[model samples]
Target: MQESRLRWYGHIRRRPPDYDSNLALHLSLPSHRSRGRPKTRWKDVVLNDMSEC
Candidate 1:
């Protein structure tokens, strides 16, 4: 699943910067303090996979 997701992301990256997928991927939200551990983000997963490669 991770590999396939990353592959799809690669395809999305090839799209123009104005593309919705690219915009969504690069979007960032304001940070806030949470009561518990933070969520596992897609970016984090991709980074881990990249390190493994």
Candidate 2:
């Protein structure tokens, strides 16, 4: 699982800065949500694994 996440991370990183997938990864949207803990996002998973490396 970690290996696959890293592989996909690398693939996304290699994309052009303006690429949809890459851009979306860094997109931020202002919105309201219920009062509760937020779910872990795909980017968050990949980034957390990266920090463990």
Candidate 3:
């Protein structure tokens, strides 16, 4: 899981997912849905084995 999170952070940073795309694909909802701040802190969100810390 830790390794995967690191890879995912790289992927998201490289591509920098658009909010609309995130909502459509991950949330499976219309673009009009309300949004909130991301769950993870940006630094931890980009790190490896973050949950263990």
TM-score, predicted candidate 2 vs. hidden true structure: 0.83
Q: Report the C-alpha lDDT of model 3 over 1-53, residue by residue, as the tens digit.
A: 66776766556556646755343334433456347864554455545365666
* Worst ten in a row by lDDT for model 2: 27-36
TM-score of each model, in listed order: 0.82, 0.83, 0.34
Judge candidate 1 at residue 39 and give its lDDT.
92
Per-model tally of clashing residue pairs: 0, 0, 0
**Model number with the top lDDT:** 2
* Candidate 1 least-lDDT 10 residues: 1-10
- Give the candidates in order of TM-score, highest first: 2, 1, 3
Q: Which 10 successive residues of model 3 have the least lDDT summed?
A: 21-30
Local accuracy of candidate 2 as per-residue lDDT tens digits, 1-53 = 99998998899999999999999989988888868899788988988998999
Ranking by lDDT: 2, 1, 3
- Which is better, 1 or 2, measured by lDDT? 2
Q: Give the whole-model CA lDDT for all candidates, comma-separated.
A: 0.87, 0.90, 0.54
The candidate, 2 or 3, that scores higher on TM-score is 2
Q: What value of lDDT does candidate 3 attain over all alpha carbons? A: 0.54
